[model samples]
Target chain A: MSGDERWIHTPPRESATFDKHAIAEIHRAAATGIYDIRGFGAKRKVPHFDDLLFLGASISRYPLEGYRESCGTEVTLGARHAKKPITLRIPITIAGMSFGSLSAPAKEALGRGASIMGTSTTTGDGGMTEEERAASSLLVYQVLPSRYGMDPDQLRRADAIEIVVGQGAKPGGGGMLLGQKISERVARMRTLPPGIDQRSACRHPDWTGPDDLEIKIIELREITDWQKPIYVKVGAARPYYDTALAVKSGADVVVLDGMQGGTAATQDVFIEHVGLPILAAIRPAVQALQDLGMHRKVQLIVSGGVRNGADVAKCLALGADAVSIGTAALIAIGDNAPHLEDEYRKLGTTAGCYDDWHEGRDPAGITTQDPELTRRLDPVAAGRRLANYLSVLTLECQTIARACGKSHVHNLEPEDLVALTIESAAMAQVPLAGTNWIPGKGGPF
Target chain B: MPTVDLATAPVRELNAALHSLQPSTNETVWRVQNPRGQHAIAVGLDAPVTVEIDGSVGYYCAGMNKQATVVVNGSAGQGLAENMMSGRVHVKGDASSAAGATACGGLLVIDGNASARCGISLRGLDIVVKGSVGHMTGFMAQAGNIVVLGDAGDALGDSIYEARLFVRGTVKSLGTDCIEKELREEHRMLLRSLLDAAGLPDVDAAGFRRYGSGRKLYNFHIDNIGAY
Candidate 1:
């Protein structure tokens, strides 16, 4: 037999468990002696919003007029306790991405975009920036375990406060900002020396448990004079218990982030394996609120892998009062634009596959601290693009709501949804398509 | 002096009154009576005023204090003077856990012994405890000075970063990445100043031992896995 024919007859076999990517990761760890760290969320496919489809109106359900009927998308948060509750024209909001993780202009663009869409923008671990505060009409300041640059004046300046209990990307882990991103300004804000790998504390220094957290909440209220709302955010590990505890600890709102939530930098292992998917987390969280007789009283904001209007509509239908976006928003603001593909290739990544946010070499200028890279992104144009994206998402949500025979987006319920796969049916607690079976809810085949 | 009794008025009213004071207000001296160990008493004071609390205060007393002097006649509960900025907080009696936690700028003086985790995550805050401090004191402290005149409990200055810790008495143990260092002239001067600020100028700064980070664990390394 010829050499080619002999090779074809006995082709090499590869193990499924140790695939090319897995082999490459092992080789990298062996060479570097450190686990791979990257940005963005879980890249592995899982049960998500795409598995669920809306059951549009027919003879059984009446549909609203497509063009003439108006579908409301307004949502009010922090109405349970705070004197000043935030009212948003749309249910979608910009999630917390730190100034250090992202550039200053990116933060300003987020604020501007959220303001134009009449939604709120959130601050992250580093601190609140003056530019962000001035740009956004409504801002939510996060009180993280690090307390880095946490100031009382800024607390009072914020429209709302979010107490970050854990993050979805690494639920039990703390934040990690590598040395490359720790510029002079970032170091000054965090009170750390420039060009050092900063590791934030996993647990809060002062309070230990929920009882102590209750007192801490009281202290925050006293600090703000009860004028601003307090939101308790938790990674989706034990959503039912966390939601209950958050409410019991006197939170005005609860933000649940799933495993697919983006982080600036984290271990690849943690990003893929830590918490529950957003689809599986929402039902349990909603049940907890419902059991406590606070389903809508204390608003629920679901996040993690929220892509388009369908994801927003699905989240609302599954009982979330609102949805927050991070990775998607970054993309809308030119994070991985095709025009920068050549630059991305030089960084050993494609445009859509770039996740080295911690390296501070982003071509799109959204996640870098380099002045030259940062100057490439015009805040006004990026902000306008984000606003347009947000507008489209709202319109698409309204169209879906109208088709579901709902006058308001909040009126959409679980009854208007069906799961295409049994795994999604079990996770989302929705009936499987073309069948009356909701896997764990007990229906005959 | 304006006197507000906690028994008569809600804590909210007292905080509101404190918050309403302007920077140049003449009502700079105030007295808080009948605290009854209530939580969040006299918290979030921004003006350059002096607040004197008659009774014991509960959790987070003088938390997030700015440009104010808060004096507690009685003992303080957990997280006293937490995140204080540009001010002074003095506790006449013993302090519970986590005193002056995460305070960026200010001076925290405890006349009596302090419980575990005192000055934890201290950021540029000068803390002086006249008596002994409990275990894990100055744990993960980034930037600050913790001076204990008496003995220190186990694991003193665990995972410390840039924070200087001085103890006059014997330390039970040193935490990971924390090591005793030579008490140089500059450190002695700093200790003396901190002691003077804490109202113990008579104490000898030379008697104290200095401890700080070993410059390890600042950046993650695989060789340091055992310490972690």
Candidate 2:
């Protein structure tokens, strides 16, 4: 007690490298002999959109009245080659979250919410669900490596098709759906045993590389009768190269997912260590597009840690045609709710930190496949909540755009942004705040 | 039978023509000329029509075919009959890599040798390679049967799930979690039927050895760490 009391008086110092969390993780690894697998994105704080601030119009530039003036948020995707392109009222779209990872009601809610906002919702690894298809007005079908539930009929019925090359949470890794979540319905869809741990392949079984991808895209186009838009989705590993390759492969749209993008289940190390931040990726992707003279021709959709309208506006300014949201959408529909604190505590977690989605025991009824917990979420109510959140995001983006004197959200350029930090200035390709100096690009003082 | 010359018209036009056919259309049979290796020929056909391509074809020949029977009379390039939904795709000559890849339904009868990753990710499709198949044949195959009459290359049926592999000849090496299983009567019957449908009714199903998932890697465990 004397020795402990003396140490407590001076205040215990925690090592930055080996903090409490790291020590616990080491002990856990030593005991379990397995790497920690969890849901959600990187928890580490990286250079993000928060590092940039918008410059409000002043004496030199006039600000439009937010209440009176209008700011256009509408965006069109997949216009390059497809006979039919998708037009959305807002630039915010729902990212791919598999029916296997999420409850059917949650999938329906996502579809309903996106439909309410006049945007698109996407199908994930396990395939398109009947409920999601019926609920969503515009749906994008994902062609993942597993090809689970990949039906030609569904492909024909889809508004767009996204070829998933990699996921942001684990760029070079495959998807893992623990046996706990692989219910009978999910198993049937994926053509697997009901309770087996499903591992999706990292690469497509048929084709390899950009040259092969070109032919694959052509095959998809042929299959859809050139009717549906074809999108190429890549994790933010080599955005510039990937964007260029996607363009060369005849993609109508390129969907870039950054490190902060969430996954249903992956190794925690892979989630935190791999992939670049969205802030560092968007500019390079845009540069590639611009270099190819395919900047707006082949649309780009950015995802990962995009929380509010400012992030949306920032993404659009950085040359992304739209922004897709996964984690935020789940949060909007009441995932990790504070009201479920008791349930979270039971799961050995807190409300905001409950990321054990792979366990399939989500108290909010969003991530779990357990019937009791799933029944807790009413699709209509959750859908309405998601729609409300999406509306707020759109409004917030418009507010920023209007204040910057831009008639359209797309008009908000790099000139309207300044980085609060040097790292952000270089990554965002914008000047530092209170100075004309850009880290890489020398500017007038 | 109506004939379409690919040299004169683009593959797109031929595909468009094929797509234009309805279920009740009188054009029940069609022929393709100009043996050139063009990609995506006779793709996305949703009718019960029979398409006979007289020569070699390139990548994704008869891809996503539904109801239609596409007969490639010569050697085929990559991804032959990929994602075929129904009907049959008969390749007369040696086929390139990933033959019948991810096809959900239908029968793919390759009369000649098939290259690497043959029938990879097969989802309920029945593939009968009369000759040999190249490396990694039937990798991660979810459902269906791959009946190889001749030898199979390395890593056959790697990480396979539910799919049945019946090989009459030598297998180079079995992939992880894949093992030889007893050729039971039910399997013999299934193989017999597939062989019969592949136009090899006389081949004895008794001569073939079956391989499938050992079920060890189905659930992840630290003990199976070396396999990964």
Candidate 3:
């Protein structure tokens, strides 16, 4: 064997080229007690959404024509009470992304993309801006604990309202906008000092708990004169309890976000280890709605790691009325690209390794305030790309629906799926690989 | 003037009645004789009209108002004059919490007292209250002036910036990084203008003290680190 070939089976001490800098950094972090915690999706490598596939239609199931068949993707959110309910042309809507975490251009791009696809975009902690509201044809305004820029005129103008109690990325943790991301405009809008790390409160100042939330809901309805639909959004920790609470609190819609969700910025440990996965959380949320006899009456929107058409279908089958996108949406519009490899290397990362969305030093210009970098993104072209990607997902969903012998996409059911793991089975609430064993089901008192 | 009694009319009908009326130069005064704490009494009126509400009002009275002058003769509820782009809204009696919350422009004058969270998340509006304010007043206030003629509560001006706070009475406590500063001449002039415009008797802008955000919390410092 040649010298290079002989090294393949050689001992680690002689063959391995250790990264001294990386090892030193790890040692320092360990000594400082900062190395124990794992960041988002880093603890264990579970089967990501990409591993799953849908069984296509065959001779056993009748297929529909690609053009002629109707695989409807429309979703009606906040149908229970909102005067101006959101009627999505597609099942996917943009998730709540804040102004303080993102730049005006980023927000505008999202709005433009969603609007082009005839879907809705939501505002986050720092509140809505005139530019965002103007750009988005259908926008959902968030009423966070901070009540950052909440106002009646804006509420009236909004198609819907989402009361954000918690997020999937870091459930129970309040919002944090690092100082570097805080611009003059964002600071002015949120009424905070420029270049300051702003922490949003965990509890609503006016209302303390779910009991008070009901009254708060009534007050909001009164203020809006029963025009806008109110939504209650929560992280996927206690899906059943939270879902019931949401319904009880008179929410027209319930939004449940899973652990795989993205954040502008959060502690690495909190993002990964704190919350339940999207798959596990969906079943309980649906059960809550079902138990309350409010299923389909009060819409359920699920989010977190929903990347492709299959993930969308799985969520729908598991009982979500619609799916919302955050990380995937950014990806569709080019968040981390190969072209930004050099910049990523400068930050000691690659395109895929880039997770410093909150640092405002995004190499791809997808999440930055730097004028030179931001100018790299052409809003119009990016919007069109997103719209196209959305169309492809819709087509894929339709293909699966046709194969499953369902005329419409909403006809997908949980029985159509089988779990690959115990965690997946628990979350999807589906039967295990071979046996019909569901862990929590049929357990004696 | 057309009189629509909210006691019998639904919120929509009452608002519709108000919206139908054309406020002309000849008709400057509008008297709501039987205003029984109706919510959103005068919402989104861009006309330069004067509405004198005779009774107490529920949440968001005269919300998103522009050019018009709304005078509530009795106590007001939460978020009174919320998001008023322009014009003036006057609450003659004690107002509930969150008075003038998130208002971007215009002047909201509360001649009596205000409860907690008064002017919370205030944008550019000017608010002048004659009595005490409860906890967390002017929390996250971005800009504009909040002049409380009486005592202020704890956590006042928490996470505040540029937004000036002028109080004449005792301060219960201050919020994180919020400190009491000396009232400068410019601040005094601004306070005087606000008082005069609101038609309130001058209560010594000198007696009133200034409160603002300490620049230390503006950036995250390695030394001053603890609970985020």
Candidate 4:
């Protein structure tokens, strides 16, 4: 064999510390004065739901016949002080993504799919769009730090209101929508100059801390006349204290977004290095809720890296009233279809590996603002695909629940799960596979 | 005229009655007695009605008000007329902090002195303070105008945006990117219109100094990232 060909069969040697990605990042950082800004969640792997395994029923326990047994998946959120609370047929809801980051058609598709599946969809930093509002039967209007398009009339129009303090991908920092995505419509909605990069303030202009937030919640209640539910969303930095504070702020529901959550645009350093993972955050947040005697009274909706039915089932088993999806939802709408492989290659990335959503050149048309690129997506068809995906997830979660002999998905508890790895066992707060031993908790009990 | 006493009616019932009133209904004018520093009075109204508070008001009084007119006879507490959309809110007595904060539209006329952050984030609202305004008046103001007839306290118009600040008296200091601009013909006309709207047509527009943003911090720059 030739010299180059011989090296293929020879054992390859590479340094894990100075890997290609690390080297490339160093080069890129050296070239550009600013930090790397990109879209999507952390690329590095961490303790996730995959590390945990469910021990299905056997002789000692009981299993239900798959088709014969009924497993309920219904969930009700926002029942605290709201005159009208929302109930969904399923426990999976769509996460908040701004109209500026996503195309109008994409937002509409998310709304359509969520509505068809009998769930709710949320608005983002840029405020509620007509297409999204019209498509979604249950729409949650987010009151972000920017307050970009906040209006009293729109406050009355929303089904529910979520006051956003922070997002997961970059907990302490704010959001960034690059100039390429800032179209005239976005500029008009946000009252900023078109084609100019926008940065949202990290804190609310009106209110500062929890004390002000308490008063702010009262003001919101008064403005809406207590007709709609109010939610307080926080990034999972200190889930215990944040959850407790949110409860004290009179939140009807609490939305906890973890580190694995995707951002439209943020510094690359912030993504991989900030906040706790969803798996590690849930127990603390649930403990906070239980401590306050508001465990099930104030529902908790979790988000971050929820991929399929297994993730939903796991999260529900861990005590989440409902789960929300963002990246998975975008994928369901054909964000990086295999058919767009050729186009993705032109952008120096392959399909399913493309994460530069802030560039606004998405081949599948889900994340782009270009007219030609956006036209590639057919909202009706994509929306149908999303609905089909949601249906499959529900079916799979139901299958798992039935196998565990659970009549309802919410009935499946942490006892039904075991960790395959020691790290997973510690993070998930569950017993190790063959042994009923929890690493952090004292003995078997 | 319809009168409502706070001592007898619960806040819920009083607010519910106020919230349910129609603009064309018989109660175009309301007299609220013995407010006694209660929070959230005359809030969330979207009618062309008039609410006259006979005594001192508390926090968030007339918050998110739309189209209706609210007149406070005594000293107003914090966050008076916060996030008001339209119409008028006239504070006859000295006002507390954050007066007309985040108010997008309408005319807020504080006849007495206004405390700190008098017109913070004033978006599309026209504020006319007859007496002096305390420190940090018009902080991060996006749009509209802040017309201070008397002396403006320290760091007036801090981190200002497109909003115009017209002050008639002494200023202690200026905040970052906030500087005085020449009062051209357009500014004179704009100042005159605000004074007229606030029923201060007698106050001369020429005596006021117009302040606005220096056009920095509008966009992100690499060299100045630290400051931004």
Candidate 5:
């Protein structure tokens, strides 16, 4: 009953209307001033490989000297029926890339690099070149669906054979040759009209399914007189079933590629949409091999975004016998060299943004046919760089093993990891850090 | 002439026996009786020995041969004399696909017929098939000679580079970038030498027509790119 002007309803919450605030001003300052640079590894800032650390022992564990202790990296591929097994010096091998996708000099450089590090380099859909085979101490040849330049003599000459079913970047896709990369020699090997875009067949003309593949494998073995080991490579889709099938199909080794893998030429949709991540794929493949009681008997080589020693350690801990690198190896050999920043800008991209491998107009000379640009990359120097990178990786892996009280790199286990994200927890199959909940195990969140 | 009986021999032992031969200026001939799909017989022979298989072979008989003469009386399985270098291979019956594939240097003669991709990627070798060839024959051929006495399948020399295709019979179709060309005298001369090397009785080299690339697809010119 006080004054009639005041006494309006007194509410628990306040409502006010005012002019809009400047949203872009707050975001612009934060983005440009502090948080602009992109971080390495997976795109998401989840608990990745970095979260897992080794536990060193004080009294219970013994320490091995960095120089005195022996950490062996020898891997034997195709031990099941190969007349001559391939013995490697390191656990990592270079993947199959074509002479057409990369210049002859680039191919030669990869071979020289891999050979120097006591590893192996592979040939792609295109046939093996003399320069590559001559430079490489151990070479693996790929027999693809197109049968491009497939020669029995060359097959016999190779140290090993990999029958390519699908690649991780494009599971159902085939090999692609842009018009620019098609040279006289490349055309001669692929049986295509020269200077035209070429697409390889998805399936081998002679053989159809896995049953026929078994026969084909036998035929290939017979052709080489069982001299070389045979490997079956598959994209990481239903890897459990594929691994089992590969073993049944008489493959001495199984190579599985994940979603993050790169391709010489493929559609952006295929690259981004198809295939599973390597982290999710590895456990299933290992489980399949274990179920067959063939684990570690037939080597499993996993590949995707294997960037450093931590990734290598994680893969091995997850049960991969070895790992193969393609994109990462290319990066190490100056694929996206920062020195070509100006050239990259001209291509409407930055150094890291350049992924026009299909165009064959690579500025860094890592993938191109332009004679002048290719000459910029010195094969000897690039080889030495790759070797140096490999050594650093090996050293870093050794350092981690020492910290964890593991005498060998294979001693890493899933128990050592704690996931910071639900995806990491599910993929790594470990408990979340500072929490008891596992999203997939208890139920999806 | 020596007779090697496959009924009582292993292919490995037979190859070992053949490897122990000495160089002779005179031609040494071996008649292989009852081949019955024997594999890898007389493999990697450097000497000039003539092996006459009386019947069919399993796979890769006389493979990687250098300066030898191999004649199969019947049909062959996959990869017959595959990757043969500097030799002569004559087939009395039909050949399977991929015959003379990746052959570095030699002369391959198919008297009856050839299946798909005959003389695929032939490198410096010469192939003379009396009958029809299958699809994609001479695919990606770098440098070689392929002479067809009969009709050719579709997409013959589809992505052929430098190898030459000579056909006397009708062509079902041509592959990408492969076009029919005028059979010049040089081509005729080359075909004659290949036929002569394969030891076929004189056939009319002039009757054959040549197929080659028009050189349009040799360089990528953005305007002419086709859907792959």
Candidate 6:
């Protein structure tokens, strides 16, 4: 005390455990008598792709010439049981976003962009939209618990089928399409009132566990004459166990969505507190495939917080066959654009911070059901922008692959990567920078 | 009358034969003997043909049928006449579950009982069950008419939409937003037509009680928690 008595002035410091954010949340909950519900992924900082650094070719490996030696980005998904497996020209695909949460035009734009790039787009909970079906050459139909707008004819026409076990943003939680966004078309398809808040069941009504899922897959196969591939999509909480079960259940492809993936609406507490980050989720999912001797045979698609091509290449290096984008795609189609900064400010949030999709008053017209708001987004123009973004991502991924001396994007391995942080080294199972030692997984035996 | 023994023939051959026939083909009446509880019998038939399954069929019988008339002599496993666009599927025996699920347009006649989730997510399909339906029948149904001649199990028509449900017998419990609505002259007429289409015109439409969405839980309200 005598040493500190010289001149020490410390301002009021908030509690580290109960900071301002936590206090504000407590106040909000106390006032509302309910939990905070919001859209988007986890906002809290966690170990991510930036923590891992790629070790470019220097001595032991030879880099491919960038000018002519083309790196193949093509991938074939669901070739195991389906007669007509989806063959993508690129290793990037669009993640499932429901028609209820997104406007019809936004769904169309996504389909157009995917078709232009020779990739696949997915239909989420509410059902398949006519616009999406008309625009997309390859469409993956989702079999969700609610079975809203689910038709066997649509299943037969789909290029692939995705059985969504759980989503990454809220692993065990159900989906919520607020009353404001439930338009006439959305209400008709889901069999609900036009202005009602519709909640989807977390568990499938007919089937319970993985064993039942196996029988369901067989039923779907018979329904479509084994033409379309079956994909089992799971959140990344128990990637090891879930991936193993999905493979055993006769899934041709496994889509692992990490906690960083977006949602239309969920409890804000569940979003930040539940599930694992994509960076930590990939290695374990790959390990399950390797154990079953189905690695690369049963394709794996990782999703959550994928922004640029570097992230995609990193995912492939970690043994993912492809990567899916949801929030990034919305951004590509002018979501949260600076041009709408004034409108966003009027909504009480800035342009880059506008994630209140559940409000149904989106200025960019991507996430609203209002006809006037939706009119702001021209599908043709938005689709071109999305295509440009996808092209840029592909080019960046190719650049990274070429630097790693890989002829194909799938050939990029974990050996060409190092971790910048100890946490990433442990989570991603990669060696630390400037060292050949991995903390938990010992080196060379 | 051509006969295809399903027990000996591969499913692909049988489906291929059904798929190749034109809508106007006169050789439309085909008989499938020894179905032996096989799945997806006469699926994806766009032709205006008639397929007669002589034995019990497994899951997804007559799935995605368009303009095809399918008659099953025995019970169906699950998802009978699922997503039938425009056709008629007649089942002599009971249907396991999800009978006439998500069909946009069709007439599904279940001579015997239908188990749980019967007519689940049904969209514009007209289904008439001769016997009782298990719990959660007509759940989340969009735009269709379901007629049950016998008692309904628990939570009938839970979260139902525009679909109209008519139960001749007592319902154990009504689901959220599902209430007993008055059967007016127009409703009786509509039910009479549906019953006639399902080949059950002898049944009295006045004996049935109409049930539909109460529209109370449509918008979110704190007081509506008990409804859910």
**How does each model score on lDDT?**
0.93, 0.93, 0.78, 0.87, 0.76, 0.89
Kindly list the per-residue Cα lDDT of model 6 for residues A95-197, writing each as its tens digit: 9999989999999999999999999999998889889999999999999977778777688779999999998999988888988998889988886668877
| Worst-scoring 10-residue span by lDDT in model 5 chain B | B219-228
Question: Could you tell me the TM-score of chain B in model 4?
Answer: 0.96
Instruction: After the best TM-score superposition of candidate 2, give how far the Cα of residue A330 lies from its true spot, in angstroms.
Output: 0.4
Itemize residue pairs with steric clashes in candidate 3. Answer: A57-A403, A280-A427
Which candidate, 1 or 5, has the higher DockQ? 1
Between candidates 1 and 6, the TM-score winner: 1
Q: Candidate 1, what DockQ?
A: 0.80
Query: Where does candidate 4 chain A have its weakest 10-residue lDDT segment?
Result: A436-445
- Model 3 / residue A439 / CA error / Å: 1.1
Best by DockQ: 2
Pick the winner on lDDT between candidates 3 and 6.
6
Cα error, candidate 6, residue A239 (Å): 2.0
Q: List each candidate's DockQ score.
A: 0.80, 0.81, 0.24, 0.47, 0.12, 0.37
Residues A1-445, candidate 1: write the lDDT tens digits. 7767866666677889998889999999999988899999999899999999999999999888887999999999998889899999999999988999999999999999999999999999888999899999999999999888888999999999999998788898898898889999999998888888888889998998789889999999999999898999899999989999999999999999999999999999999999999999999899999999999999999999999999999999999999999999999999888999999999999989999999999999999999999998888888899999999999888899999999999999999999999999998889999998999874311
lDDT of each residue in A1-445, candidate 5, tens digit only:
5686466766565333321223443475466542121111223222345644334445766656777676666788898889899988877889888888887778888888899989899999778999899988999999887667776667878999999998787787776677877778877666555677665657654445687578667766655667789999998888889999999988999999987777887755567667777877787788889889998888899988888987787777778878888888788889888888999999887888677876777877878877887787788888888877777777776666666566776665665455666787777666778676655763421
Tens-place lDDT digits, model 6, residues B1-228: 878998799766788788778757897899999999987788878888899999999877887788889999999988788777889999999999888877778799999999999987777889999999999998877788999999999999998878999999989998878899999999999999988888887989899999998877666776776766
The CAPRI-style docking tier of model 5 reads incorrect
Which residue pairs overlap in candidate 4's backbone? none
Candidate 5 chain A minimal-lDDT segment of 10 residues: A35-44
TM-score rank order: 2, 1, 4, 6, 3, 5
Off by over 4 Å in 2: A1-9, A442-445
Per-prediction share of native contacts kept: 0.74, 0.76, 0.22, 0.31, 0.09, 0.31
Q: What TM-score does structure 3 among the candidates reach?
A: 0.86
Colliding residue pairs in candidate 2: none
Q: Candidate 4: TM-score? A: 0.94
Clashes of 2: 0
